[model samples]
Target chain A: MNLEDYKGIWIFVEYTEDKISELTFELLGIGRRLADKLKVELSSVILGHNIKCDLNLLFHYGSDKIYKLDNKHLEVYRTIPFTDALEYLVNKYRPEVLILPATSIGKDLAPRLACRLETGLSADCTELDIGPDGNLIQKKPSYSENDYITILTPNHRPQMITIRSKIFTPQTPDPNRTGKIIEEHLELNESENWTKILEIIEEDQEDANIQEAEIIVSVGRGIKKPENLGLIKKLSSCINASIGASRSIVDLGWISHYHQVGLTGKTVKPKIYIACGISGAVHHIIGMKSSDFIIAINKDPEAPIFQVADIGIIGDLFEIIPILIDKLTIK
Target chain B: MKIIVCIKQVPETNNIDFNPSDLTINRSHVNGIINPFDLNAIEEAVRIKEKFDDVTISVISMGPPSFEKTLKEALTYGLDSAYLISDKLFAGSDTFSTAYILAESIKAIGDFDLILCGKHAIDGETGQVGSEIAENLKIPQATNVKKIEFHENKKIIKVESDTENGYRVLEVKLPALITVNKEINVPRIPSFKDARKALKIPIIKWDLGKLKNIDKTKIGLTGSPTKVVNIEKFQKKKDTKFISGTPNEIVNELYQILKDKHVV
Candidate 1:
């Protein structure tokens, strides 16, 4: 229980197809800052059936050391083997803090590790800082995304947190930076994993979700019918923007689940978000409220969406959208 | 086969607002609803009971005594029984501590075949409890279970769970846990007839005294590794500049603003 035993900040360097994920680099950016604030070393952990991943990129990002478990058993992201290997590494080289990207792997593994270590872990933290006593100060939106709650793992050694993607920008790669790479022998065998990845079936989904779109034209119940979506599409095509919808529209089967934008849906941080006819429930607002420029057009002046919009036009979206389309086309 | 479904009661999200004075959630201002996702888990349990022979569904929740309201609501879905693990000491427990108490409850129940939970609570959205509970019980766990099928006298359960990368069809042994989302099945509304009958079934309430060998340090807010340090409203430019006039004038105004921002 002595905090002195855990002395370094560690980032779980996740990989996809032999390349490091952006979240790993983002954590490195924040992780390095935390390490500096705590006056401790920064390290990265990678456990994969890897033969081809490069380690230099990790150091270039921010890692002072890399603790890796490279073995055939570690190739797949089965819960048991990874936990066994990670638990061993964490116990051997105890960390003051452990940060992981809130990807599926991290979501599955972080809790198991924390449970084994009997430590506290914050999930989907958007903001993190070193507190006055060297504890982790983590902030995340509460269940409804209505308010942000700050969390601290004050008493636990190796305080854990899983941060959401895009919360932090990554540090630039410094090719000159060098770090130690410590490899561990995988003690876990295949027999330890009770569950198996029967088969991975990746569907070819070409649609651009609101999360990655630069410009999103999102709609809500104000659209009279599914056909009225054409009016919004007209504006999107004119301005080269993607289509997004509120949960009500998606639940009506007017659009697929992938295009829904809300707390129950995808979180989007687009450059320009156009809310047409959307009443702006707290759920829908939280998803796209982070957009750079928001323009809300609705007949109801008091619609909540207008509260977050930079420019609020109180009018019928059916009327406003067509006129805007004409203007954009003419320009 | 005995199935245990984990459910949680959370604030109705639609009306959630924060206190400006202290950025923390003003829960008193918001009404409570059984987490929408947990309803799906309860439905899956009911559906499994209907399909299989000699199957009983038991629902469990950890919260204040009032949480029993949600448990009664679940019983209306035709579940066999319910248990409320409510205790003042359990307050402020994080996902880990919460999972530990549930795991202990499962062990105490003994002779259970399966545990099911919603993928995540909408309020917390952590999605960490099922896996952590499985780890504590040393049972296999699967998340995002889209479709699940039991085979060979319920020795193994086949599941198709969605991951960020793709869907993986996994087969895990019995005495395992699976967390499901909306993709699994449509939750049914409780029938009035069943609701009446459900009200008659006395709910077994377990407090800290009921759970034996419970470590005091690992049960409540004290045992929880995570602590809430602060709460703040996530910032957004809330005030807006309304563009008034005719539809034509509004469009013209929007175009000029877009032009100034170079959004065009």
Candidate 2:
């Protein structure tokens, strides 16, 4: 009933060791656009211990206000403490919209916060907009298949949106932009923290992180038998490209699902994506469509993949792949 | 120790095709299977049951009546009991409502020391329901669990879960919820004999009428605060050009295109 109390838009800034997460800037970029359209101020929340970062750093990213919860217990990324800090800020400020990343910490915290506040949180969203009736329109893959679904939370306060990484481009930092930073007060105690972080060890996740690679040479079922995959790998290595596979290739047991690139697999936005023996199914196309340059080498002239490729080559990959390995020898 | 692992039936994606007209998956042509991560959760619970002398593992799923088959399959994996929560009211429920009903059903099952789930359902992919259930039950939660250990006579549990950067080891008190990732363990396949014997046991079924003290406004699509407003089919770019030639000529052309794109 007190809808007027809820105003500005807020971004949950996930930071560590004085470096802000890239997703924060991206949210700020999109949040600024949304906030401007609604004629509301864009604010950010920072929770950390002994935090010494320059508050003005956020002003460059178009943030109009910053809410700080600084305490010794707020240093590391603990679930309870972080969630409590965020919950406290939202309940008091009553922001109309809140955005967070779909990272591990965000994934753990957002759902709990939404439940605690009795609001709705949309996860892994790729697009966000304010609807005509002022509701938040959340766009994301339903996670079942390749199609995008638009979701709206009309009744929840601080309508929450969790966005996946690399979904949006961040804006350039402007030195002239200025804003107000308001430090908040909070009562912190160790007893309230049930989960204890004894150690933090980063896992070596080099396998699927290839989605971040510059050049990727991916193979599909068109590569045929599992043994013939050697030709695809040889070409990838010749160009110093990462190896990727279509869902069918993985399903056929030719490669691990970790190398799968499709709606069910990882969404890759590489610089150069070479699809070898790929028929360009929609499932495979969505994953690599963002590539700056795509070249499809499928024997079928009518393969759907050529539609998205910059240059479509209709020929036998069995012969062309070896020549590709020899012609552009990166070594 | 009494543990509950929540799983779901997901449409096997490989055989399904995207309906270009409405941008929805054509599920009529595919079959459903246990969510991949949930199988990891079931295996972890089974491993725990094997380690302890007095442990009962129960598997729960919220789906249509056909999901009774999925619960039976869970029993073949060594779980002691199975529960299926199906209701006309639950047909269009979102994540929050789904978590609420599951939490209430877990409460009805009585005291439990552990609750486990897949980090995210393959279909919804929100990765939120498990934590939402924890919130509804007012318990601690650890997500993306890759490794877990019991300590202090099962008074507390320590776990190392995967994160975007790597992994973090955290210790939480018992009677908590955790969502496991795929790296936990390789799930065991259901044996034909175990599968057959498992189906002989009657599955516990509960509908909205059976669940007590639940707010009706929060159970189905009406209780769900979110709605899908639009579904648009993906349209590929049409400006691409085709090239056909001898292997040498095609390679030369591609090499030139890559150079022009500065794709090297």
Candidate 3:
């Protein structure tokens, strides 16, 4: 385990539908800072089939170089093929640090890659920094926002961590910046492959995609009956806000898991997050704490949601939602 | 057919208590529950067993001896056997070491046709164990699986795996691993008869001594590559404006605030 043999910092670029994921750019944003601190070049690793995009966009975001692993088999995200390609790349190049997004695909690939490489990986990290001792310091919530554990891979080469999205602001794209693109090829054996994609079904785009919503009208256990979701839908429609829910209601089958807003679900940061009847647990709070403004309406004054809310209203959601809806509709 | 379902015992509540002195979970006073997602895995395994002929399911967990209680609860769901891999040396294992230990333990348990686990545990929520186990065993994996079906030949399995916006139907060969999502199935509760029977059934215990050819440096805290260097209580200040009034007044205040921000 010669740590010195590992050099540059690498961010695995992820793509969907011919577009690079926004989370990849976010990693590049933080990756730039860490690379500069460690005095190493930052690179982007992209694997796919016939990826038709301007590679300069990555350099614009901040990458000194791009490694392209283009193969027909690499087109789809199967765990083994993707992991095998990355394992080969990491072994050949020996990057000092590797960062990935904590998305569904990233979560699946990262652990498998780390295991094959025999390295360390931190998951869903909220923060990354270079320590005084020159180790990459990864900070993640230990079950709650109030408690955080700082992790480091002191002896491991190519330290790894999966970061959540929207945590950092991507740098403005610089047209003047350009980098070299390196094309790498590896032999992928079909016999070693164990999974085959039979079909893909993309759900219709619904107005309830709250991750990108500007305003969110979220409900919780306080909404009581499943029928009460109508009231929330009315408020959301009135304000043109997307609907979100705490895990409790989703667990109760009051709504689809798509609307769930919490740790196990999607993390959202809308401009206005109106939480109704939500006694926010720490798990739920970590997902939405970054919202620009939070308004919590709960009967219990001591609800944990109120602690983080900019505006705390004490009342029954059933009573208040109708009035609020009526008031907003009149104008 | 043989199946191995992996489970973890997590704090029953989200308000996890931490030891003030060491920043470790203060497990002394906390009640544990089978991780909610693992229950889904158990249910999925049970459904598979019910659908197949001569299928046997065994549940395994790597934790303190107290975890045997949770494993016993799994048996009430009609699992064939339970294995507990516990040792003082396994304490403070990160996901890497934890997965290594489980893979070795699984090897000791002999061969299986399939492996199942929860998407992730709530306590740590790393979600790395299942994938890492597959990697160690050199098998393929599908995560966030919503539905699964064995082929007529019973050698290839097809599943509906969840993605961000949609789902994909994938066909995985036998001897694969999968981590199931909560949407997979509704877990059943143990009946009184099964509960009583489970209490009498003995759970197999395995320690380092039971696992042959085990590497000493790859099973515990010292073997873990990633180290927790520091832990601190997070603090954030918010100047909350508590609104007090009638429903109409509250609505008026909120409307004004939203209007100022052009939210309406």
Candidate 4:
């Protein structure tokens, strides 16, 4: 475990619907900054089956080089195969820091990879930087959104961290930029995988995911009855917004957990977030506070949600929402 | 069927304040509750035990001795036995060290058919311990699991893991680990009789010495590679513009604001 053996920063490149994931692009933005600070190269590692994309986008996004491994076993997102391939790469070409998105695929792969490498992996990091002593400084929100703790893997090589998407803005891609592509070969035995994928069910597009929604109309216990969701629907329809919910309503079975916006649910950052009848608990606030513009309608003037809202209206949502919908519908 | 469920007791509320001087959570007035997701894991394990024959469920946790109270409460959910690994030396362990302690304890317990854990603890929210344990034990793992079904031979498990867009069904071999998500099932409330019975059940306590061949450096803070350098209060802009008046007036003002922002 010689720290000197690790020299560069690497970001795990992920794909969604054949294109590089937005999160992976975002990682390159931060990875570029960190690599520049350490005076080391920033590389993107892609492991997939028959990846057809030129992967010039990695360089355009900010990668100095690309390490790719293409094999039939690496096609689908399986924990064992992905972990084995990554373990091979990290050992063959040691990286000082490895970053990944805290998305479903990344969360599943990073921890297992960390265990195999016996290194430290910080989870859902909100901030990453180079410390004074040249260690990767990982900052993440603790139990409470109000408190953030900075962590450092002082004794580990190839420090690892998983960051949630939308924390950093992706840089504009420069098509002129190109990087050295290093295609790596790994012999993976299919028999090593103890788990087999049976099927992948893509959700029907009946509703946009709140995380991807441009505008969100989120509700809470203040909405009262289940039937009152009609009011929220009316408002959302008028504004072309996706419906989001606080954990309380989601837990009460008023809405699907997919629409939940909070600590246990989804972290959403939309263009405009309208919180109706929500008290704005720290849990709920952490999810939507990052939205570009936040408007809160709550009867309680002291509701914590108001603390983050740009525009706060202390009124009954039942009365306020209908009129607001009418005004928007009229437009 | 032998099932091991890993659970954690966390602060009841996420509104914990930070002690800037020592960079620590101000836990002076906070009470602990079973991590909410772990309750789902406990309920799922209990449901499986009821659905099958010869299914013995054992719960494990690592924390302060105060966690024993939580383990006892888990038994009220119809789990068969409980184990708590607590030691002063294990304090301040990060996820890696914490996983090592739990994995070592699981190894000492010998053979088991399945391991279940909450997707992540609410307090730390690392979501790593479950997967790390599987790696340490060199077993297959399915995380963010929403549903699970057993094969007729009872040697393989098919699980639906939540993905970003939808779900993926995976078939994992026996002796695998699965971390349950809150969407899996609703936890059932125990009756007074169950509580009384749970009180009568004895809990097996383990210290650092209880884990055989355990590396002392990897079991606690000293073994931990990561260190908390600082704790700071999150700052956000508090310049909220309050709109007052009748419902109509407020809506008109809000609509005007929205129109100004070109949102309408």
Reported per model, the fraction of native interface contacts reproduced equals 0.77, 0.77, 0.80, 0.82
Single out the weakest 10-residue window by summed lDDT for candidate 4 chain A: A140-149
Go through the candidates in order and give each one's DockQ: 0.62, 0.63, 0.62, 0.62
| Off by more than 4 A, model 3 | A144-146, B14-29, B235-237
Report the error of model 3 at residue B76, Å: 0.9
- Pairs in steric clash, model 4: B217-B223
Q: What's each prediction's TM-score? A: 0.94, 0.92, 0.96, 0.96
TM-score of chain B of each: 0.91, 0.93, 0.92, 0.92
Local error of candidate 1 at residue A177 (angstroms) = 2.7
Distance from true position, residue B27, model 1, in Å?
Answer: 6.3
Alpha-carbon lDDT, every model: 0.83, 0.83, 0.88, 0.88
Against the correct fold, how does model 3 do in TM-score?
A: 0.96
Q: How much is A100 displaced in model 2, in angstroms?
A: 0.5
Runs off by more than 4 Å, candidate 2: A191-193, A204-212, A220-265, A277-286, A299-307, B18-24, B236-239
Candidate 4: where are CA atoms >4 Å away? B14-29
For residues B127-224, could you state the per-residue lDDT of candidate 3 as single tens digits?
A: 99999999999888999999989899998899998988899999999898999998899999877887787787799999888886678887678899
Task: Report the lDDT of model 4 for residue A151.
Answer: 91
Task: Provide the RMSD of all predictions against the true structure, rounded to 1 decimal.
Answer: 2.4, 2.9, 2.4, 2.4
Docking class of 3: medium
